[model samples]
Target: MQYPRKSYRIYFILLLIISCTGERSTNSKNNDSAAHNRTRYFYETVKATEDTREKIIYLDSALASIKNSRDTLLPLLLDYKIFYHNSLKEYDTSFFYVDSLISLSGAHRDTANLAKAFYRKARIYNYLGEQEEVFSNSFESRRYYLAAGDSSQAGRRTLEMALAQISGGDYLGSQETATEALSLLEQEKDSVYFSSVHNIIAQVYHERELYNDAVPEYRNALRFAPSLSDSLSILNNLALVYRDNKDFDKAIATWDEILGKADSKTKILRYEDNRAFTRWLKDSTQDVETELLDVLRLRQELDEEIGLQASYSHLLKYYLDKNEALSRKYSEELLKLTRKHKNAGMELTALQNLIPISPLPQTRSYFQRYIHLSDSLQMASINAKNFFAKIRFDEERKQEEIISLEAENRIQDLEAQRMRTRTLIGSLIALLLLLALSFLIYYLRQRFKREKIREVHKTESRISKVIHDELANDIFNVMSSLEAVAPAPVVDQLEKIYLRTRDISRENSDIETGENYITYLKAALTNITPRDSRLIISGETKVNWSRLQEEKKIVIYRVLQELLVNMKKHSGAKLVAVSFAENNKFVEINYSDNGRGLNWKRARKGSGLQNVENRLSSLNGKIEFESREGKGFRVKILIPS
Candidate 1:
């Protein structure tokens, strides 16, 4: 559907207003102490004002109060600070506050609170262009959210991760992540988050050029976003999709709606110009001169109002194309405006125009300037691509660490619950003495079972820490340094050595976490090169993750993890592939690596490989590994969840 251009302009204006305002509300305070009470009061007073200036005053007052109070108030104060800093685009300051909140949450053993801090940190990292850090922090935040039983946040984190993947050009990965996040949001009845998930789904579809599928998802985003502001941007994007689909009428209708809601005079003018241009382009026999004149006039008007250098350059080009006089006037205006903004595109355009119009004495300087700007723009594009790749790589690695940590936490919770079950059984036996002697013996056995669980949890915790604390940190540090230095490809490969070391560390943990686990597999894959890494992920049409028993899910996760690990460890070939096929009765996973094929007949099964076999066996699953001397290894496992 076409959105009015007015909608787009109105949305930005509202966004600006929101960005400028701040407040601290007393209602949000814990109400635990007199100081908290006062702080809350001060906050609410500021927040109550609709006036932007008054709101700022309240924020400043609240901030001062928090700074003067006990150290206990630091988290509260920093939270507000983060809010304002983010609004102001002070990302560095915002991140510092988020980090402080995380540390405080850790000190207090507040897992849920810590998760929020981490989530904010991830958001800041995203804004700062630190894609890897954003992924890692977001993963950690999701882990903590799950730990805190905050399923909504957990689901949102998944959505955010999907966005990260999409932005990194991992469309397949994004599709999978979006599917998972959507399922969670649907279950939670979270309209806002559900809308976000749908938006990501649409984005993935769009990125993959699957317009047929994307259309429905975009419609879903509009359905859920009841607010005009919330839906406008997506509406604009949908219009773009229609434009891509060559549905000119539909695209124009969408733009019409955007124009309807536009609040700013400047934006409305720009929108009119775009619409006019699009319309002119669509008509085969349109008068080019008339169109050019219209566009040039629009640019001149906006240029004077907003100092838009691009418009000035555009006007200069249009005049030059017509071989008309007054090119010098536009050129001079573009140069003056470019001096203030230093906008590369406008500057480049101006330089190119100057190449043709320059006085005989200054032509060389114009050419040199053009060449220099072109090179800089080229370098910038290269840097952007590399930065995007690094973000994707880092995010995937961070996800592994988060999964491992969550697994350990889940093990501990299960152990605790088992202990309680045993205690209850024992107490019941105590009431019946002789008649319950058999029951008492069973109770004792259950206690032993619980103790076994505790032991297992302890082992898992150690392994989780190895990856979470030791390996993740080391690899992250390496990623950080690499980003800081922008090394050549050869140096980049050497830096990747640290990433390989991290893989080994995660692998070492896999021996205890169970073979073929998702976390282990993901970690192993992140360590390998794209040329060497193969990814195949498939599942049932609609797997009910929440309904499945935890142990069963973990088992499936582990099986896949182990298979991938072995692939990375042994696969000499550059290709890896995975496929999931399901029938009415069973789900099958096929993992293949183009490494030295494993010979099931001649291979000596290590403890880790054997353990994978055993876990699958417990689930009534069968495993097969087929590999020949020069071929790659392929492992197929079938199980029911």
Candidate 2:
């Protein structure tokens, strides 16, 4: 009772002071209410099952909180922005939010926040297809993660970065990333991140054309994802890779295992996917009717109209090669599918396949159809590019607007006092007028200079095209005619002259666009490679040469052409296999011959050998020649992609 009297006296004095000040009741109460609302909203937004749906709700709550109070909850608002951009695949916007959060975090210095920022930046760079930027930011993220001493979390990010590298076609880079991740996750044997490392290694192997090496890694990934439904597709891809490596027995057995586990109630999509592989395995024989019937059965059971058309297209090629009566059956099926899908690309493929097999009278009609479809598809691709460009442009514009607004606010604050002065405004006006006059003069001069440059470029382009087309064509034709004449002293001299002229023509030709490289290579090889037998040019035959750097790609193209020519003249090979592997760091050419093995000593004096050596040397590449006395010849050439 005595202590209560003293405490009561102190409490009365404290309450009197608080009443006199009276500032906290309104502000603190409002803040508490706002915080309560925000907490409720945050929980409600985050409660969704789906990631994208949750992100949408988060964004809505964030926008609402901004309306109520932005200064107190800017950090969460920034997080919301990041989540929104990530969901929408707007990576740059996500990066901006991350950066904002880092700056706002102040003395707290959130390491996890910085890690996330760096990761987001890496992801953005990946989306923009900037390889250097992707690696740089990914490494930066790794550094931050390392500094934070979060090895497991760092390993997961490393795995994701490895996947980015893989998608960018950097197989070696991905392999390194995967190895690093594997080392980090080694202690955690049952960790999901460790499983990802295995999958990434498989992908890297797949990209490097080491399908055999990929099998076990994929199998390991499957083990980790055993009960997870997403693993099914990856298993299918692994099986297909096995099949590609001609391990069909294993592929079939694995697929059978997949089918056995697949119940009717599992999922329709999974069943359909399994059916595609099962059908593919069944058709891996040389029987056209049997394959066609299998394809027809697939069409009956599965709702994959597009896949059925693809099978039919393949069958069309098979029948044309076999001269089978079932050609018309597949062709009719293709026509039906094409009409249903109205997919220009698929329609063009079907028409092209049908063209060779259709009756002679029907050939022209199919050719016309093919041309129309191809043109439409090309136009659609162009439209898509334009659409993407427009979206990118709008994003850039929005970013610019935000930058300008912030700058404007800064400038307004700096000039807040000066803006009231008419004298200061007059002085600024005079300075601006002088600047404008100078800018006008500079602009006129630059415009004139650019116009002059344009004119010169146009003239050069015209002359180049004219010289390339008329003179080169006429000289090449004369050289062809002269080669047909019997070899003599003068004829040999003339042939040397022809070879020199051809070399000059190729060197002087356009390397930048290189649109004619593949076409010219095709023509040159056709003239040189034996036409009397089967030669297969597989693996995305219609590659856009413009995607390559002119000089290097031309070197590869010419090298392949020379290889084919040598094969025709010397190898006596019946089957020629030419493979084009487009990848990051290197584009490889695999040319194999089923002809007699090469004699290195004899080949030393060959002109074709000399030509290949010269071309490969110019491109800073080397040829790996594989041949025994009797088996066959295989030449692998690698160059920077």
Give the C-alpha lDDT of model 1. 0.66
- Candidate 2: C-alpha RMSD to true structure equals 47.6
For every model shown, what is its TM-score relative to the native structure?
Answer: 0.44, 0.39
In candidate 2, what are the lDDT values of residues 305-385, reduced to their tens digit?
A: 766776676666566645556766777778878888665556676677677767887889989877877777666545544
Candidate 1, which ten residues in sequence have the lowest lDDT sum? Answer: 1-10
Among residues 3 or more apart in sequence or in different chains, the pairs in candidate 2 whose N, CA or C atoms overlap within 3 Å are none
Tell me the RMSD of model 1 versus the true structure: 42.1
Count residue pairs with overlapping backbones in model 1. Answer: 34
Give Cα-based local distance difference scores for all models.
Answer: 0.66, 0.65
